[model samples]
Target chain A: MKNLNRRDFLKTAALGAAAATLGTKSAKASEKLLSEDRLGVLVDTSVCVGCRHCEWACRLAHNMPSPALDYYSNPTVLKEFRRPDKTALTVVNEFENDKNPNLPIHVKIQCMHCDHPACVSACIVGALTKNEDGSVVWDDGKCIGCRYCMVACQFQIPTYDYDVSIDPHIRKCDFCTERRKEGQLPACVNICPNEALVFGKRSEILRIAKNRTKRKPDIYINHIYGESEIGGTSWVYIAGKDFNELKMPPLGKNPAPGISEAIQHGIFAYFVPPVTLYALLGTIMWVTKRRNESADKDKHDHHSDSHDHHSDSGRDPYRTSGHNTYRDSGHNTYRDSGLSTDKDTKGDNL
Target chain B: MKPAPVKHRFFTPGVIILAVLALNGLIFLAVRFISGLGAVTNLDNNTPWGLWIGVDVAAGVALAAGGFTSAALGHVIHREHYHAIVRPALLTALLGYTFVAFAVCVDIGRFYYIWHPLIMWNGNSALFEVGICVMIYMTVLYIEFLPIVTEKFMGKVNLPGFLETFNEPADKLLRMLNSGLSKTMFIFIIAGVVLSTLHQSSLGTLMVIAGQKMHPLWQTPVLPLLFLLSAIAVGFPMIIFESLIASRSFKMKPEMKILSRLGSMVAPILGVYLAVKIGDMFISDDFKYILKFDVPAWMFMAETGLIIIAFVLFLSKETTRSPGRLFLASSLVIAGVLLNRINNFIVAYKPLYDPVAYFPSFGEISVTVGCIALLVLIYRAVVIYFPVISHK
Candidate 1:
């Protein structure tokens, strides 16, 4: 018995240790703050010429399906709104310029790569991670394809390879993580004809974006779309019209996961709430058990007092009546079926 | 007293239909596994969860609340009168969770990596909490059902062929297991209840991170509490619903006195649930959204309206006294919770960018229907073979 108990203790200890390590690993991902030198892109939508060269360049860089570079140059494709999907990692949609209706403003839509990404916080398996380079990348090897990330992403940027039967991966812009490794600019930035997309350190780009907005207040909107929106995104946009007019969702300055994590962690902090709940339930059970025992004792005394009368009745009236009708049916078929009306009155009396 | 098998013929038209549905579901499942979720489901990136998660997982988990509630009533609370229903409720829960896990397997794109959550713990993730809890609770449920299995096979382990040689040893093992389980059963029962409470609420927490995606009508900080309360409210009703249906099907007398007492309990629980739900909406100042006449608004109205009706009916003496009325009231509660879960997880969730609507494909619906049919078939089989349903 001692040996068995010791073995059980050892096994439990090992399991607890492993669980603690894994818990710390998950917590670390959330605790890591945005890096100071993280890269970002400042998109001056006012200067974008609606060329859609970035779309062609992004498809080529991601090695996704694409028409020839010339096919993307067709301005007619901008008639309808478009979103980045599994086939396309990035897309450019043209919005009718409210300030200057003659020239349409084109906004490139891709992963915003928020400082505190909802997708990373939502992933149960820690498959999506926020890297130091301001890139929110997904590890296909770690993904369980739960798609909670897709549901949690505020921008709805992550797309799934739902068509693939085997080893399908979530598709999204990685901010050209591989290209950055070679010290090369993002495909869309490199391919922009008018230098509309300015890539630099996040702080440096934010300074430039603020300066541009201040210098050209008449030509630009008084806001940076991604700055402090859901805790600030790596991709900032400066448009000539209201950001809402460009189909950008109006979000609060607070991080997306703030309220959610606070509520979840508040209730489950150190598992205190669950433990308290169990204790409360246990107390209820104990009280009920004691009350029931006393009630059973009272019934026992009452039964003993009428023992002779019950014996004369040839059955314990309390036990063999009312709700116990089905129990009695197995033995006394005549009483159950033939004397049904008599039994009903007797059951009611009991 | 030990439960005994009900003597019912196996080949009813209802059973045949259920079998057909189960078989049809199996065919779709094969397609889903081989051709991926896209072939069998209309689920895309915007709508990752469809009928499978909403109906099969969420509703199924809520419906299975009868297990913990019954166990708490019978063993922990020492309400021996409820003992008659505990076994059946436990069986239902065991089967319910089993199918829930199976549905999850089919729903996830990488089905083979389902075990990853166990070792790859993300304590901060509500889904991680839900997954771990459900997995542990399922095991606890099965453990709680072990004594019944032992009771059924205790002295009847006589085998007819080469296996006959091990019959005596099996009987010994069975007796040992039965005795050992009885000693430690309360631990598992308590664990089951704790785990159930954690996961039931965590299911609501799973959607909290969706934040702005979920409609304000269903999304609130108090959502987890509401989910847990609703689950608790529906627990006794689920058991009552199952018991009344089982009695009618098996040609047994409905335990009216006991069932009416159970029915009476529902009103207070439903009262608490309704109060919390309405209060949460009012406090959160989301009641204005109810006037929008949108799909989510209508769904919220219907969901709350059903529960209110059920609560009113349960409070009435006539409804509690009549078995049919009681069954109807219980079914309403069940339907209300089911609608609440589906509405929160699917109907009320709208992606920010995607204007495209999502409706489960025929194959997805079939798979969900088949899962329910299979559950019923298994329940019937268990009651017929094992000592699940009460004979006396």
Candidate 2:
């Protein structure tokens, strides 16, 4: 039975190693191979009417304690910009267009669901994963609540359930994965009165966004906010004013994990660097030991010769007139005492 | 070289104060577990990691690097003169790591699921690498300490009544284990050094993914290399600091000759760390950010200035030769590294949207202080009972 268990353990270990190697390779190779039919939403801020019905719908759909529908009509809430938190999955904030103050822009904030997510790469326990449908989702059961995802997120979208004492989780918008599976649009998209949010395949939405900007150059901004930012996002945006004016961060086109992973993997590839480092340390230890051993032998020989002469004169070698001679010969005595004692005890064992 | 315990009173006013602080920290921890981290800490979504991670984990790990450095010098390299300091260094490291793990348990929200990293691997995450390395290294450290435990108890396992029969068998088993372990200790030493290198650098990699969130002064591509170099630079100094403090407290003559040699080794490593840091900054054009006269700029200047001072002090033979001067220089290096870590993890990091500033609460500060005090107390207790300090 013991032999059988040992064999099983070895087999499992070997298989685990192989799986780990293959998993990293596939993850790297699939960086740009996003699903062709991945879902996305294009938000046209120019057309948004600033009514926060989407926030109410999101709360209602997610089983959160939302206020009465009449309460959301109060524009005073928009006066103070708010972020999506544990209580709310999505929020709408008002940004006054500097070029035209009369026409204010309403921006909806939630998880961007990047194609190459930093949170997915930062989660130490594989709790977060970038789904094929362009949604960055998390598994609560596997999450250790390290909150590294919060730090890794370029958009800074994920929030923690700090209020809950037991089984706290990281909360964020999951792109309404359940609604999509049921052939229904996201709660926010379905509730938009002006069809400000258009949902479809990412490529189709990008095409439509380009066509709209090309057809009416005066109506839309020249750039799409999430077309390439952080390796693209499921939620794209087009606004009349600059994205900065709408409170969107200006991010580079490259994926957020690109540089960090590059350096990390470069050094640890095939575990070559670690193995080589260990070998180098061992070699240094061997060389230093040989040199020290020879030096100790020379010192021992010289000490023994001095001891014979001192004995002939009938005086203690470790003691002088009215003082300890060992204390005066600092380095030599310190070394000889420790080294000779070690030799007497564990020398043969080494 | 057999070691004997120093004779000192077990209880003192200082120990009483530490016990009070520890009790207070325990109460706060109990509240934290019952109510949540929100009750005790100022950590929010904008600042998920605070003083616990910055000080307790990062600084703790860096200070514990003394164990590997001293072990390499004394055992693997066979520098017999360094043998006196190795055991104490190991004990400090063991206690430091134990508290670091405890701090992680407190800091993590799902403390029960802390073992998930072992089964569910995310090799791409730098944190994953750190977690695995730390776990394995901690185990190796414990195994390395087994010989000490065996040495303390072998042939002296005196048990009363029901447990008397087990003593002989236990002693025999320990003798077998000790003989076996002594032959293979070099492997663990090599493994310890390798693991330390991997994780020490990986700690810096944890911040690299922050990219724009981190201030330009600290965010560079060669952060892993810099972290590794600084950790190596601080290793010997940490040993010297601990050795001097331990000797003074125990009323023993400090091993000045060997310690001065160790002090001499710190200069070259510190010089290399400075060169790499400056070279990386210049190459990345991050020096431009230093001209802004902002908080991050001033912090950067302070951190670098402290290290430069330590480097210069260590270069002088007179400074390295004096125990008092050496202790001061080593303290500066420790403070510089500690500040660098805190700045990288907290001060220099600016979340994009959140406007609320974060400062650790009183509960947080007390818990960190209490953990350090508890570690010192444990170190004292272990050295007093076990033969950790070499006999004069």
Question: What TM-score does each model's chain B reach against the true chain B?
Answer: 0.98, 0.97
Q: Report per-prediction Cα RMSD to one decimal.
A: 8.8, 8.2
Write down the TM-score for model 2: 0.90
Q: What is candidate 1's DockQ? A: 0.28
Q: Clashes in model 1: which pairs?
A: none
lDDT of 2 at A206: 92
The ten-residue window of minimal lDDT in model 1 chain B covers B74-83
- Residue B203 lDDT, candidate 2, scale 0-100: 88
lDDT tens per residue, model 2, B1-392: 34666677767787888888888888888888999999999999888889998888887888888888887777666765566677877887788788888998999999988899999998789999988998998988888888888888889988889999999999999899999988788788889889988998898889988979989889876777788888888888988898898788777888787789899999999999999899767666777888998888999999999999999999999978899999999999998998888888888788887787677899999899888888888888888888787756
lDDT of 2: 0.81
lDDT score, candidate 1, position A229 = 90
Which portions of model 1 miss their true places by more than 4 Å?
A1-32, A282-350
- TM-score of each model, in listed order: 0.88, 0.90
> Model 2 over residues A1-350: C-alpha lDDT tens digits?
12113332232233234433443454467565688889899998888878999999999888989999999999999999888888898999999876578878899989999988899989999999888888888898899999999999998889998876689989888888888889889999999999999998999999989988888888787999999997789999998888987789899776777666655665577698789999998898777766655644544554543331111111212223212333456547645654332322222121
Over all chains combined, what TM-score does candidate 1 have?
A: 0.88
